[model samples]
Target chain A: MRAFVRALPWIGPALVLIALVVLFPIGVMIGNSTRDISQSGVDRGGVGLANYAEVFAFPYFWPIVGRTLVWVVVVVVLTVVISLALAQLLDKAFPGRRLVRMAVVVPWAASVVMTTLVVHYGLEPYFGIINAFLVDTGIISRPEGFGWTRNPGTAFAWAIVVAVFVSLPFTTYTILAGLQTVPGETLEAARIDGAGPLRAYFGVVLPQLRSALAVAVLINVINVFNSLPILRVMTGSIPGYDADTVMTMIFKYMQNQHRIDLASALSVVAFGLVVAIVGVYLRVVRPLEEA
Target chain B: MRHTRRASGIIAITLATTTGLTACGFGGGTDEGDGGEGTTLDLLVPSYSDATQANWEGVIAGFEEANPEITVNLEVESWDNLESVIATKIQGGQAPDIYNGGPFAGFAADELLYPVEDVTSDATYADFQESFLSNAEVDGVAYGLPFIASARALFVNDALLAQAGAEVPTTWDGLLESAKKVSALGGGIAGYGMPLGSEEAQAEAAVWLWGGGGSFGDADAITIDTPENLAGAEFIQKMVTEGATQADAGSTDRSPLMDIFIQGQIGMQVGLPPTVGQIEENNPELEYSIHPIPTQDGSPFTLGVADHLMAFENDGDKQEAITAFFDYFYTSDVYVPWVQAEGFLPTTKSGAEVLGDEESLAPFLAVLPDAQFYPSTNPSWSTADSAFKALFGQLATGKTAADVLTEIQSQVDAG
Candidate 1:
């Protein structure tokens, strides 16, 4: 108690910073979610949870929620699986491995919006490189009148692919760091105990990556769930919310609908969903960590 | 003790930060004041062309030379972001002293703007065309000053029409038949450039719905699901199903489709004045003619669009400076050049008399008398306009015209 008292000044600023930056905004968002905000953003008096009710009553709400789930699950799963394989391969110390690893960071290092825009333009029907190549190779003919992102389904699929592409570097690096910590002696011991290479890896190395995998999965789940740029740039202009995720829907509610109150309500609902999903994940992972 | 000195040091740092922050707050407040030092006005306007900022800056230079006590800070934003930028600025309590954009009803409804009479010289207020001035009124009180105007007319690709053995369409049925004939030419060519996409679907909606003898309702009510409006929407769906428009008309935007039309691939489209400049710059060889947009009964229909400049009631003290700025801006010497440079129809009578003789702008001006506008005076028009932009494209997809119109009607009703 005495030491904590003495340390208060040192930590006080950090606590104040957190309160101002994080807690204050959350409080304000919750308050605004209950208020009636005009299109010009004038705040009318509180309306309880009417904004939330409006959000739930929105025609596209359920579909957007479903798509958001699919987005988070598919992107995170692909990212984790691909990163695992890439990490395993990199651990073998191949030539040009340093250069390849640096190259892996390009999509992650570049601005997500910029990268998505390049991909978006590259898929344009008129002069896009991809469409040109496809036509040249006789894969698609010009008479078909098709663009790569013409359909919402195809556009959402491409957005997921881009999401996985950008998510690879961080997940791979985390898993690679975990792989390095697994001592070589343990793998040799497992091999000497009559296990095959695959068996040795699954038995010896996989269990040691548990904590790192947890961190990667948790972070990727949150990041992919909250991602806006890939979905926005890839399929934002498509008429309906058929390809929309919750993050993009929140943006559309404010931008297209001019319903700031609705956006805030959706934001709070999204916040709660993230917390619940992360809680479940932690509960499932904590026992394994202890073991 | 060392602990006592450390605690004292921390307290001193906190005191210094609080004082510094408070000082900044006071500094910002004073800067916004119209003191003897000078009155600084923040003018936020949308970019009409690449030269938009330079033109405004030139006006400011002259205005400042004439009135040395007023300083105008200019911020130019793209038309796509202008609405949200103004909204954000208003929400942040930093609304500009003057703003140039469309849809002033929401601001006027909130009493965030000074009425036109308060912010403009009496002469300048009287200078606006009667029709245009009345269009800016909300509940019989004007809030917006007409800044620029453009009217839509049918742009026919003469070469394409001739190749397809079609003439310039004068009625709805004639339009469909002509578009079909052009589409039959094949080779990745769209018959009619129909852009019902997110960018500016409302403009296309106005052209068709109004042409079909439907209205988007008056200020008191909004009626989107009328039979005439349905006919208009069904025409778009027909265009899509018959392969008269480009692929994915649901997602295609206006600017790019306009580019295709400029490339001489489209037979006909409704276009604005700036499209003339675009064709000149990109494809001067593409022969085209401007005609009245086809109506169901062969009556003249042109979708008139105008952007307005409005003054905010910020501190209720910058009125004099804003008035001076408006008077200076609306002067013929200052206004005519800006209008000519941007290639838009002038909204004032004097400015019109000067530019009505320009060859390229004459056709649009000829159609201006029959012009109709979106119900921008209604506070709910912004909501309806957005609904049109976001949902109108669904007609090209699988959504029925009736359903889409009903959905838009419900949105407007909810508002």
Candidate 2:
């Protein structure tokens, strides 16, 4: 009883914050999803799993779910790999390393919307520099420019590209910081044991960077999954086209279609997916720590 | 370490609570100030353009001169996300005194809008055109005051037509023939361009179906799968299959299609009266003429829609002010200048007279009599719109029109 009373003051604030911030919104979202929300207001009816049923019944929903998964996986893997490579390249004592490091962080500093618009307009068929070069270099027989947004494959690829581009700077910087903390003596010991640069990197450097890599990967996954503006601005939330992201779909349903209940339901589903992904990640990484 | 942990826990709880409360308070505030019985009237219209906003201000000045006691607070919202913004405001109990919006009556009938009966009277209703008045009526209750009207029309580039030696198509057959002739020019130019992207696309596509004597939903049941609607779908499919339109039409929205039209890459395109203004701005020397959307014979009528000025039922003072402002807005001096500057057909009979005198707007006004409003009187018109869009998107992507229509009909019926 004395120990409990002693901890009450600190525990009260933590409980209040959790209840208000995380639990309360989740509760509201769950409640909203079960009702028929429209332009008028929420219709407080017992729509037991009906919104979820509709989401499942819709043919486009699964494809979007599949696409989102692919989007997250591709984006996370590409971001981590590219960022790690950049971090390694910058880690070497090279000329203009400071300038290169600054350049690396520029993409992270640029607004996602600004970068998307630049990419969108810059890839225009008639006037875009990309197409202009392709045509000028006789890369193709026709002037039919690459429809980065219109084609589904290319759209997915570009979405991944944008995700990686936005995520690269921060992840790279973090990995670089992680590399700096790794003792030089470990690499020296690997080199003395006749390990090549590649072998030493794989056995020593990567293992040392595991914690940073895990954090980077986890953050990248969440950030990419939550990203709305790039896809929303580029695709305008048209279903079955470029709008495959869960956030964009939610925005479309709630704002464009006025189907708040369905949006909320989808949001809950998204939240569950995120939680499950994190759980699986933690479970998988547990063994790595003990090793 | 224990002290640090305790402090962090407190901070986290406070942060969480604040965030939760903030999210919950998004759309729950009530409007405190009434318009106060005196004379200041608030008019909320979606922002269209800088020039139009200026014109609205000028009209308010003119209105004030005529009725010195009345003042208009012209609040303009952008079209993008305007519906949600309005919905949020209205739901939050802070609805504007007088707001103009497209498709408000249907929303009102669905219980999304507040009733405006106290502000409107039978005498005031009698002054509007029958079609205009009918567009704002739901379940025999007139919920909105019609302000401005627009209809879809075909904007034809005469130079492209001349180059192809094609005449203006008045029928679906004629349109198809002309489309082929223009596409044969072989310079990346298309015969026609219509939005096939989403709901707006569906609406534009439905013009042909409706013109061909097709009806989507009846009084008690949905009928999207009728023969006429299928024929209309097939007509669009034929255009796509025959190489008249670009294969990308299924994915392109109005803006890019408009861009294509402006770049002289499309021979004919369907656009509102504003396209004339856009053409004038983009290429002053462009040879383009406005004509009625090509029909499937039998005196084809263009699809017309209107934006309505409505009042909420919460505050009496605001309602009275809104009523006064609506009355002022329809009057000749203010409404005429607004119609002329904004390039939309006026709603009132007298207001139409003013629009007839403007050379650029005359063509749109001329087709007003031949315009057909959306026929559904159901409050769930937005749902119908979604079903229609889904159906039309499938059709545009080469799905069997009959199957898509059947699916849409079933969904609408179920809804």
Candidate 3:
């Protein structure tokens, strides 16, 4: 109390500024979500829950939500699982392990958009290196590259691949941080108790990794849910909303479509949806961390 | 003590965020007359290609030389994402002094742009191609000077057409038939190229809609579901079915058509005159001709596209600098070379006539008088463009045209 009271003068000004900076935009977004966005994009007047109702009624609304959930689930789970395997391998003493660790972190250092562009070229039908390799090995019949982002299925597949690829390094590093804290004696005890490496890892190190895995998976969920640039650059929303997640769809609505009210309403709901899910996720996973 | 520490941590984070955000606020404040030098006009332009950006920078240099006191800060953004970029800037109250874009009706309605009459002279109006000038205006007031005007034309690969023994189709039915024949040659040749990628897909589809006597609706209302529009939509679907366009056109970008056209694999595509530069760069000897997009009854109309130079009011010398820069930039010495470099038809009547007989410019220039813009000057048009692309993409990807049109009409009418 003394510390807080003594700091009031400096903190008051900062607190006020922080409120203005952070809360102000959120307040405006909430306000606009309920306003009728006129044809000219001005707020005509209040429309109650009209905008929310409209977003809910959008034909692709639920489908986009379903896809977003699927995308978030897959990206988060795969990132954790892949990173866990890599982190386990990276944790052990190996020749040139420092070089391998540096290589593992390289993707995290590179720009997401630049890497996405490289991924785009790799999947392009006409001149994709991936297509050339596949054809050269007689993996597929056609000489012309297979149209990767042309359909929703392939686009979604490639989007997940790129998402997992970019997500790998950060997740691996996080889990690696957790790995360092695990006492070597605990793992040795498990091994001495007549457990193999897989059994010891599964029952001991994996459970102990709860906090780091939770942090990684939670962040990835939020990131993949809101990620727009990768799918936007890769797919160009070719099939429009069909290839976009809810966040990207919201971007299309606000930016390209200029449907401000609809975008705002969608944003508010999306924010709430994510918050609620995270809350539930944390509640369910809290026990493991506590253990 | 733990609770106090947690509260302190929260305050620390909030304070840091506040400081960071407040710092970002510094550079965007209104300049109260940078009373040091003359003035600096922030000119934002949509760069069509690398050459276009170079031409813009060159024009800015000439303007700076002519008006030594005033400095023009030239910023170029790609056309693909410029609209959204500008929208965000405007909403954030950080709009530039001058912007190059389409006649956005929303901007006009919101009065985001100053009326072009602020800088345009009678001679300026007389010199500019009337069609380009008129379309850039809303409610009797124009926003910007049209610096780049591109009228879409049916660019035919003469070699491929000759090899396939097909004449240039001047009518809608004939186009389908000829495209089918050329596609039959089939060494990865597409008879027609349909772009279903990005916001530009909606623009390209408008050409076909125009040829079928359909409108995206008048200034007052949206009638995108007109029978004529359905006819146009059906025709596009038919081309896909007949193997005249790519199987995965809905997923393909404009690069494929441009690439194949350069390689003599694409027979026909509705393209701008600037494709001459692309062709020359790729394969200079590839024979091609630019003609008007064919109509149902062999009538003539082409989609007239443009990039307008608009000003946003920032008060005082900034406004003055924008007007002054426009006047200097449009002069023949600066304008002509910019036009020659960009390869688009010169937006001005004087510039057009001066280059009227250039062998490459003649065909596109000949059709300047009859070009039509999409009824999309309205700000909501872009939003409608998304719906158009989605529904149109579905149609191209094998959805029913009538069903797609119904959805488009629903989205627009509701808008």
Candidate 4:
């Protein structure tokens, strides 16, 4: 007790914050998941993980889990790849670079809900500008334009597009910061050795952005996994389980007259998946400490 | 510099300690609110647009004038946001004394309701529409007062009907025939507008199901696949097969369906009275007619949804304050104009009697007393509704109606 008390001045605030902010809500969630929650969201009492059993037993549960996994992977991979390209392009000296970078950042600055609404309208089949433009350009017929939101495949595709749109800037900026740290002298040395621009970027600079890329990809994975706005708004809350990710399902479970206990169980599982991914990432990254 | 840093550290520790204790208390149990000289009632109302909020303020001011000793704190939550907000508040044990909501069964089951007799006058309780009261009842105990009601009816486009040379359809066969004629117009017109999507699958399906003498699950169960309900689902499929409704009706929504109707792209659709205002606002030249949803035997039946005012019990003084305010607001002079200003139907039989000759609402008002509501009584109905919504579009696919219905049943059972 004396030794712990002596250390309190240095570590007390963090321990107190974690106890109140993190552990309390987590405790509440696990406690509620063991109980029956009324539609009004009051926990009636413990039922010993019956909520978890029920949620897992749903016919679509595993499929939804698989879909969520696929969504996070696809969205995060696409975001990182595109953002890396943009970051490399922006890092090069060019006229009108600031304007292009600002344009890239606009989607990231937009309100996610508003971006979802704009994307929804832009993708509307009959009266949308995208369809009109595509039709006028003779790229697609009117019938092709009218059903993107209705079809699961196209709807999921568009959801990824919007997700990537809003996620681009932060990833780009993160990579650009990493690129800045890649010494100009190193690029100069590569060029002195007859290395072309692409070769220098690939062989010399790209390897140095490993940590930034890893951090960016990890955050994108977690964020895309929890994203609900794109799917919710574009589908108008109708995208069936075939197209829905786990986050949207959790939202559906949390609506009026909701199954909050089950939502809690699902949430705990989602958190566990995120933690597992991070754990795997850290294990892979553990080798980087010596570098 | 070391002394200044130490002082800053001390201040930071003090702030963190204070915040930690407060947060811990909030995370656990907040002390009961007690600040007023007399009683304070916090009322959580569904968010209102400007006109409706003004009317509510006027009524609240009048009540406050009549009872100065009691204070009412009106917290208006957005309709889309109220669900999560109330759930958080209720679960946190800080539920408002009165809240605006429908589907009160969960609250009633949780034993959270303050009960109507506790917060309503004897006269108002006796005079309310019994269906409104009974629908708000759980196990023979009334827990809510019906505040607004809506009923669905068929809306027809006059230009399309005239072009197709068809009259307003009152029978299912007649409706299908009209839809076929409209589709046969062949200019990219939806024969009929169908909203078999998630946002309102139950609302969309209810008109057909109820008209066919089917019902959603009663007090104890969910009835998704009864023969009558299945027949209704089959009829919807038939409408799609015959090109009497949009081929992509499963992907459509109420707004788009209504928009196409107003634009004369669809011949007929199911709608409430406000559809008139919406259409009139969008296209003044469009002519339309309203009637009851068609039935196999040409019977008069319609689907309705309602919202209610509920009081959560905390103390006798708060309950008494709520009762006093409710009695003041229930008068014909106050409520009738409110019903008129907002286009919602009357909630009380006496309010309907007062509006007997109001021609504008006659079509909807005629069916108000007998209108059936969504089966919100099942504490699990909300969960089931989402599953049903997700499965509704499967009717347009290879899945059988029984499969879709059973999918919903299985989810509800599992949930």
Candidate 5:
């Protein structure tokens, strides 16, 4: 008790900040999920679990949930795999390596909304620059038919590509840092033992990268799952939640439906689902980490 | 001990500055609330064009010059962000004194607005078009002041029609035939620009559904699944399936499609009066003619849309200042120029008389009398509007008219 009391002041400000910034909003969100909030956001008293019931009963709820899972998995998996290769390349000594490294940060340094907007207009069916280029190069027959972000199927695919694009720099940098810490002697040892370069990388360096990979994967999963601006700008005008994740769907509830209570309810469910997903991922990753 | 004393001094200074800043914030709030010689009002409006902010600022300049005691703070938001911005402000207890937006029945239902009479003089209120004023009524009491009115008309590319050897269409069958011919010309040109996307699908739905003698019912009910409405939806699906519309019509929004039309890539589209200005600015050489929107039975039809300016029930002190602002804004000298600049029809009698002579405004003006409106006075109208925006695009994705309408009907019913 005395030790904890002595430590209190050092941690007190951080505790207050978490309470104010994080815990308070969560408490309010859970409270709002139960309340009968008006479209204009007037709190009309509590309705118990009725708002949650309505959210469950929403017609597109399950489909959107399924799409969200696919969205997170595809984007995060692609990001990690591509990032691993890029990190290895970036770690090697090369001429103008620093310049190339700076160039890689462009997508990350630029605003996500601005990046998505550029892609959105670039894929316009008529007169888009990218569409024109494809037509000119004989890659596409014409510039009028390829509305890449308009159809749900193609829109979802393009959104995944963009999600991976913006996710690369931070992820690559993380793994690259992990690569720097791997001892050169170890790779030399594996090479002397008659292991091929590929075999040495997979068997030796990869295991040392386990913690960094874990951190990268976990953060990417959450960030990709909760990503809004890419999908919002890409498929926002496309009607229906056919391509929506829970984050965008929750925005629809508030922006389109004007039902704050329902949005709050769905938010709670989304929060729970994210926690469960991350928990399961951690449980699986922990055993691997231990090994 | 000396280092500890220095830390305590820094903390003392920080606490003092924080308290000082908090007091200044409170002081500013009270000054805004005080009903003395000088008063400030908040005005929130959506950007109609690049000129929207300038026009409002001009009005404020004139109003303030005339009435030196009242000051107005203006916030201009894009049409895309206006609703959510207003909602956020209201929820945060910082609703603007006056907000210009589309649907106010939701706000009116919540008793968040002052009645029209409370915010405008009797003469100012009497000057408004009776039809528009009635459109703003909720429970037989007006809540919104109609700020701008627009009626939709069919804009046909004269060059495209001539090239295709098709005359301008008057009926639905004639339109389909004309569109097919235009599409047949085939150098990346669309016969018709069908925008069933979320941006303004409700407007396009209004054009077809109303032309087919259907209504979106009223506050208490949704009539979207009616056979008349179904016929309209089927016609849209027919247009999509027959390759008459641009590809991926489901996700094409009005603005980008309008850009295509301006570029002379689209043959026909339903357009507003402002579309003429856009065409003039972007591609003045493109020959186009405006006509009455084609109907199933060949009767005259047009979709009328209006955005309203409403006063939130702010503190009691703002009522007089708001009325003064409204009266100043509606005066013919001030209102007509702004209307002309924005290229929208005026909601006041005198402003219309002044703008009536302009050639481009004549076609839209002639059809204003027969224009059908979305049931915006209905509290459920926003819900129904959003439903159309989100679901009508499904028709392009091979969802049947009946299925889409049934889904929309259920959404409205649930609301």
Candidate 6:
């Protein structure tokens, strides 16, 4: 009891900081969600779940939510898988390995908005290098013209491409660290035991790097879910299939339309989704702690 | 180490609290100067390049010289996403005293703008051109001062037109025929180009509809589904399909269109007067002439856009100073140079008369009588724009004009 009392002072300061910075703002958001936001400052009213109901009732709400989920899953999965492959390939000592590493990190270092603008203007119909090359090669009979990001399917595809590109460097570095930690002696032993490269990778290296993989997956999941800039700059906040991640939708409601209450509600919903995903992740990975 | 950490934490907390308190203090304090002997006015204007800056500074210097008691601080903000930034500042009660209140004033009027009814006088308001004044008036009160106005005109590559043996089109059918001739000459340019992307597309599309005697709304209700509007939409669709414009017409913005026109890739484009200056700067050899937007029924109609200067609700002395500054702004010394720098039509009758005498500026001034203001005052115009853009995008791809118009009308009505 005395020891507990002695530790309370240090813990109290940390708790206060967390409560003020995080919990208080969340409480305020919840309180705001219950009020009506007319021209006047937040109307004090007792409306239980009405804002949530309005959000659900809107025709665009469900489709946007569904699209956000698909966006996060696709971006997270592709980024992790491709980055893992690249990290493994680059983990070995090879010619120009340092240059390849630098090349991989360059996109991450550059501003995402600048990158999107380059892509947008570079792919523009009249002056874009893509069209110029296509014309030169005679692959296209006529100019495919513009509108690459105009269609929903192509827009969504481009969004995933951008997300993956921006995410690759960090994910690759994380997985590369994991690859280094997998004991070389164990791999040599597996090779002497008649296991091929792919077999050794699956049986020996994979299990060893599970913790690093967990961290990479979790980081990518949170990042892809919260990412706003790539989608925003690329598609201009169109609320479905490309620019309608949960974070972007919440921001659009708050800033573009000035619907702070609905934005708060959407934010709370997004927060809940993120928390649930993290919770499941922790639970699933709990058994691997001993490793 | 423990003591150091504790001290660092204290410093962080103190810094945060100080910042928060200072922000709160600024918000709560009166933005308008007290009726003291000396007052400072914070004026927000859109950012400009060095030449435009020098011109504005010259005006500011003259204003300051005239009113030594009042000091003006110029804050130049970028135009992109500026509306939302202004809204946030106003909502937070830290907006500048005199800010750029352009086309977004309608949005501001809906609980955003501080009412300026008391600050402005009839005599002061009378100094502006009637069309400019009327455009700034919202709900029967002048909440803004009309500063600059721009109009869209058809820019023709005279060499290309003469080479193709075509005259400048005055009507819709004539334009189509000219377009066909220009396309056949193989200059890698379209005969016409309009920004079909989002809000701009909807706005440009509306000009054609209105020129053809169609209406989107009639003060109280949606009216865009009429046959005339459909015919206008169909004409745009035909232009895209027939290669009179590029298939990518839905995505081309003003910049790309201007680039192609400047490069002599396109024979004709609908652009503003500023484009003429740009063409002159980029390619002085390109022979181009400006004319009014072609009408469907052989009448002239052009799209005119205006910027407004507004006075927020403030102290009496600040109001007087604002009024004086605006009076100084309208004088030929300040107004003429500004018009030339911005490449916009002058807001004063005298200034417009002066610009009309210049041969290069005459075409833009000539079309002023036919210019129509944007037909919307809705706060949700941005939303409407995107919806309209989507419909037009579908139409440009291949949807029937009638179906798109019906769908758009329904959507606007529902919203």
Best by DockQ: 3
Looking at model 2 chain A, report the run of 10 residues with the lowest lDDT sum: A234-243
Query: Fnat for model 2?
Result: 0.15
Compared with the true structure, what per-residue lDDT tens digits does model 5 show for residues B44-68?
8999898899999999999999999
Worst 10 residues of 1 chain B by lDDT: B21-30
How high is the lDDT of residue B81 in model 1? 69
The true-versus-predicted C-alpha distance at residue B5 of model 3, in Å, is: 9.4
Give the per-prediction TM-score of chain B.
0.91, 0.85, 0.88, 0.88, 0.91, 0.83
Which tens-of-lDDT digit does each residue in B146-178 have in candidate 6?
778888888988988888888899888888889
Answer with 5 or 6, whichever has the higher lDDT: 5
Instruction: Please state the i-RMS of candidate 4.
Output: 8.0
In Å, residue A264's CA in model 1 sits off its true spot by: 0.5
The lDDT for every candidate, in the order shown, is: 0.84, 0.71, 0.75, 0.76, 0.86, 0.69
What value does the lDDT take at residue B402 in candidate 4?
A: 80
lDDT of 1 by residue, A188-258 (tens): 89878999988988888888898788778877887887777798888866887788888888777777777
Q: Write the per-residue lDDT of candidate 4 for residues A1-291, one digit (tens) a residue.
A: 999999999999988876766667667666767878776766677899788887788778998888888888888888888988999899988999989989988988889999878777777655777876776687875442566677677888888888988999999999999999998899899999999978997899888888678668766766777777788887654535777777777776776236777777777777777667655765776423324
Model number with the top lDDT: 5
lDDT of 5 at A14: 77
Off by over 4 Å in 3: A6-24, A36-48, A287-289, B1-33, B36-40, B313-323, B376-379
**Model 5 C-alpha lDDT per residue in residues A1-291, reported as the tens digit of each score:** 999899999989977875654555666667878999776767789999999999888878999999999999999999999999999999999999999999989999999999988988898888777887887788988547488888888888989989999999999999999999999999999999999989999999999998688768877877787788899988988877788888888878877887777877887788777667766885666623445
DockQ of 2: 0.31
All DockQ scores: 0.32, 0.31, 0.41, 0.32, 0.33, 0.17
TM-score for candidate 1: 0.94
TM-score against native, each model: 0.94, 0.89, 0.90, 0.90, 0.94, 0.85
Count clashing residue pairs in model 2.
2
In model 5, which regions exceed 4 Å deviation? A287-291, B1-37
Q: Give lDDT: candidate 4, residue B56.
A: 78
lDDT of 3 by residue, A36-151 (tens): 86533444789999999989988889898998889888888888889999998999999999999999988889999999889888877656888778777989675566778778
Off by over 4 Å in 1: A285-288, B1-36
In candidate 4, position A239 carries an lDDT of: 33
